[model samples]
Target: MSFRLYWPLIVLLLVIPVIILVWQWRRRGRNVVMPFDHGQEGTGFWLRLLLNSAASLPALVLAVVILILSGPTRLKEPEVKRKLTNIEFCVDVSGSMTATMGEGDRYDASMQAIDEFLEARQGDAFGLTFFGNSVMHWVPITTDASAIRQSPPFMRPGRLPSQSFGGTEIGRALLACRKRLIDTESGDRMILLVSDGMSADLGGGRDIEVANKLKGDNIIVYAIHISTGEVPDAIINITSLTGGEAFAAGDVEGLKSIFASIDGMQQAEMERTAADAVDYYQPFAIVGLSLVGLSLVCSLGLRYTPW
Candidate 1:
C-alpha cells in the first residue's frame, strides 16, 4: 500500500494555487460607492467565510490536477508461484527388460510407475527417451502428459525392431538424454533412468566424464534398477555427482514406492517475485471530479458581486 510519484519535481507547481488561495483570504474588503446607503452593514462573518471557501475550491481542484500529472504509483504485492521442472524419462528397452517383476514384467511396471508420476506432476514438462544400444526420443519435452503416457506399448523391450537394440549402453543413453535437456532454456532439468542391467560402455571412468558433463549443466540424474541385484557403481556415480540418487526396485510395489519417494524428494518449489509499481491515479481523479462539481455549484450563488 505504498505510493510514490514518478515525477516528484512537478509538485513545485502546487505553489501557484497555494499563493492564490492565501492572497484571497488575507486581502481587506474594498470601499465602493453605492447609489443608496440605507445602512452601512457589511457581509456577515460566516457568509464572508463561506465566500472565501467557495473561491478556494478552484485552487483545491488545481492541486488535485498537479498531483495527477506527477504520475503517482502504488507498489503491488508480491506473488508466490510454483517453479516448473522438466523431467525426461530415459527407459531401457533391452531384451532383458521383458523379464517378470510382479504380475507384469520390468518394462510394464516401469511404464506404469512413470504414468503415475506424470499424474502427480500436472504442470511440469515431460519427455520420453528409450535407449538400448541405440537412442530414440519417443516424445519431445512438453507440458502435455498424454504423449508420454501413450509411449510404453510401442517401445517395449521385446517389441523393438532388431536384436542390436538389446545391449545396454548407460553412458551413451545418459549423454543423449543430457543433450535433450540442455536445449531447454528455462526451469530445472532432470533425467529419470530406468534399467535392469549394467552398461558395458560406462567402464574406464566414462561414468565420471558423463556425470561431470551433466553436473556442469545443472541436470540431475535419478537411476532405478528394477531387479534383485545391487545397482551398478557407474550408475551410482552419475546419480550422486548430479545431485540425485539410485534406487533398486525388486517388484512392482517397490518400483512405485521409489517413484513416490522421488516425487516427495523433489517437491514443486515456490518462489516470490519482487513487487512492481502500478498507476495510482484513480483516487486523485475522483477527488478532482468531485471538486470540479462543487466549484460549479458555488459559482451559481456563493460568489461575490461587483458593486
Candidate 2:
C-alpha cells in the first residue's frame, strides 16, 4: 500500500493537544456537590470527562478521513512462469484451408489470427510450421516475431497427389516440432496446430505418439479447427488427449472473438485495474455526516447549559 498525499499524516499532530487536554480534563474538578451523598462526585469532573471523550471521537474520525483522502493504493504482483512458453504455431498449408467461406479464405483467416497471436505475446518463444504433403518448418523456435514473419513461407512439399489439395500430413508436422519444443529447457511448453480440414488426421501415427509423449512431460497440445462448421473427431481427440482445447471458428467474426480470448501470447496484464473499483467514500462521508448531526442533536437535547 502507498499514499499519494504524505502531507495529510501531519494533521495527526493536532491530537497531541487533545491528548494533553484530555489528561487535564480527567484531573479537573466537577460542579455542584450534592447533598445526598453515599457516593457523590462533582459535576465539573464528569462533564470534563464527557467532553474529553466526545472530543476524541471527532479527532480520530478526522484523522481516518485525512488518511483515506491521501489516496491509498496497493500493487499486486504476479508470479512469472519459471520457464517461458515454448510455442509452436503449426498451420495447415494442406491446400484445403484455401477454401473460402467469407471475404478471407480459411487459410487467410488462420494466418491473420496467427499474426495477431504473435503480436500479442509477451515473454515467450514461438516457432512456425506449415504442413502440406509433408511438414515444412518456416522458422525454428525463436522469440523474434519479425524474424519469423520475414522468413520464407514453408514451401509446399511435393509428393504424390499434388492436385488432391495437398495430402494432410498434420501428424508428421506435429512430430517434427515435438523434439524441438519438448527438449527445450522451457517450463511451460505447447503446440498450437490450426487447420480447416476434417480430412486431416490429427491422430495419425506421428501425432498420437508424440501427443502421448509430450503429455507425459506436461507439454500441452492445442488445435484450432477453422471451417464452415464443426471440427471432426480426429482433431478434437488429439487436442483433448494432449490436454488442450479444440475450438472451431465458424467464420471470420467468430474467429476474431476466439482469437481475442486466445491472447496468452499478448503482453503482461499486471497494470490493468479491475473493472469494478467504485468510490467507497460516499458511504463513509454519509456516515460521518450522520455522526456529526447526531452529535448536534445530543448537545441540543442536553441544553449545553450547565445546571
Candidate 3:
C-alpha cells in the first residue's frame, strides 16, 4: 500500500498554496473608518480565526489538485496462478497390449490410469497419441479433457486395424510425440509413454538419439511399463536422460499408482506475478471534493468583504 509519484518534481508547486494559506493566517486586521459613530472594537479572535480558515479552503483544494496532477500510484496486490504444462500421452496400441493385466488388459488399465490422471490434473493441456507400427494423433494439445476422456474406446489395441499396427516402436512413437509437443510454444513440455513390451527400434543408439532430441527441446519423458517384466533399458535411458523416471506396474492398481507417482513427481508449478502500479487518487479526490463543498458553503457568509 505504499504510494509513489510519476512526476515527483511537480510537488514543488505546493509551495504556492502553502504561502497563500500562511499569509492568510498571519496578516493583521486593517481598521475600517465608519461614517456612523461606532465603538472602536476589533474583530473577535474566534471570528478572525474562522475567517482565515474559510479563506484557506481554496488553497487546500489547490494543494489537493496539485497532488492529483502529480500522478500518484500504488502497487497492486500480487497474484498467484498455476503454471501450465503441456502433456502428451504416448500409449502403445500394439497387439501385445491386448494381453490381460488384472481384470482387464494392459491397454484398458493404461486408459483407466490416464482417465484418473486427467481428472487429477485439471488445469494442464493434454494430447493423446496412439502408437504401434505407426502413430496417430487422436487428440491435439488442449485444455479440454472431454476429448481425451472419450478417446480410449476408439483406440483400443483389439479394435485397431489388422496386423499393420501390431509391432511396438517406442522410439518412433516418442519422436512423433516430441514433434507435437515441440510445436506448442508455451508451458513445460512432457511425454507420458505407456507400453507393455520393449521395442526393437529403441535398441543400440536409437534410444539415445531420440532422448537427446527430446532433451534438446526441453521435453521430459515418463515411462510406465504395465507388465510383470522389467522396464526396457532404452525406456529407462530416455526417461532418465530427460529428467524423468520409469516405473513398472504389474496390475491395474500398480498402473494407477504409477500414474499417481508421475503426477506427484511432475506437480503443477505455482507462479507469482509481479504487482502492477495502479492510480491512487481516491483519497486526494475525496479531500478535494470536500474542500470544494466547504468553500461553497462558506461563500454565503464567512467570506471576506471590502465593506
Candidate 4:
C-alpha cells in the first residue's frame, strides 16, 4: 500500500477558524454544577454545549476530505501462460536445398511448410538453423511468434549462405541441431531436419559423443526426407541415431501434414493466457484525515463547553 499524495498544500486551509458568533470568545457560564445546582440549569445551558462543539466540526469534516483526496494502492501478479514444446527447424541450407522439387525449390517450400506449422502452435518456442557447408542460426530458441510466422522466402541459388561443394555432412547438421534443440527442459524438445538426403561431414566420431550426451534428455529428432532425389545414408540415419521418426516430403500435401504434427506439440490450450495487475495508494490520505480530525474534536469540545 502507498500514498498517492504526500504534499498536503490544501491541508493548511483547514486551520482557518470559523467565527460562530461575535460573542463566541466572550461567552461565560453563570451556572455551577454544584450537587444542588443541577435543577436550576436552563435549556440555554445545553444549547451552549452544542454551540461549543460546533467549533471542532469543520476540522473533522476537513480531515475526512483530505483523506479522500489522498489515494492508496496495492499489487497483484498474473498467472503463467501455457507452454508446450521447444522446437528447432534444422533446414538444409546446402546448395541442393535450392533444387526445385515442388512448386518452389526445396528451401522455399520447406520455409513455407515451417510457417504453416508455426501457425498451429500457441505455446511453443522455435529456432531456425541453415546448414550446408557450415551451420548458421537464422533465429535462436525464441517464442517470437511474429518472426516465426514470417520467414524470409527460401534463398535463390545465388543468395544462399554458402555453396554445397562438399559431400552431404549429415552428421554435422545433426550435431548442430543436437546442441540447439536439447536445452528447453520441459514439454517436448525436438529437431525437424528438412533436407534432400545428403550428409555433410559430421566431423569424425563426434556423432557418438553427441548421441551419448543427449541420451537422457527427452530430445527427439524427426527427419524430413525430400523425395525429389536419391537420399544419402547419412541423411536417413539422423532420426535413427536419435530414436525419432521420419517423414517423406514427396508431395506438398505430405509436406504439410508432416510439419503439422511437429507443430501440434505446441497445442498448449490449458497453458495459454495473458494478464496484467497493478497496485494503488489511497489509504494514507485517510489515515492523515483521521489523525487531524481526532485532534480537532478533542481540542474543541473539552476546553469550550459552557454548561
Structural similarity to truth (TM-score) of each candidate: 0.76, 0.54, 0.77, 0.57
Q: Write the per-residue lDDT of candidate 1 for residues 200-301, one digit (tens) a residue.
A: 799999999999999999999999999899999999999999999999999999999999999998888888978888898899999999999999999999
| Tens-digit lDDT string for candidate 3 (117-154) | 99999999999999888899999999998998898788
Candidate ranking under TM-score, highest first, comes to 3, 1, 4, 2
Q: What is the model-wide C-alpha lDDT for candidate 1?
A: 0.90
lDDT of each: 0.90, 0.65, 0.89, 0.63
**Candidate 4: stretches off by over 4 Å:** 1-78, 145-154, 157-166, 180-189, 200-209, 215-218, 228-244, 266-277, 280-307
lDDT of 4 by residue, 204-274 (tens): 65555555555556667777887755544444454556676677777777788887765554345445345
The per-candidate count of clashes, in order, stands at 0, 7, 0, 20
Which candidate, 3 or 4, has the higher lDDT?
Answer: 3
lDDT of 2 at 250: 76
Cα-based lDDT at residue 44, candidate 3: 71
User: Which rank order by lDDT, best down to worst?
Assistant: 1, 3, 2, 4
lDDT of 2 by residue, 112-215 (tens): 77777777675678888777656667788877787666543334323224654387766667777786786787446778878777545554454566567767
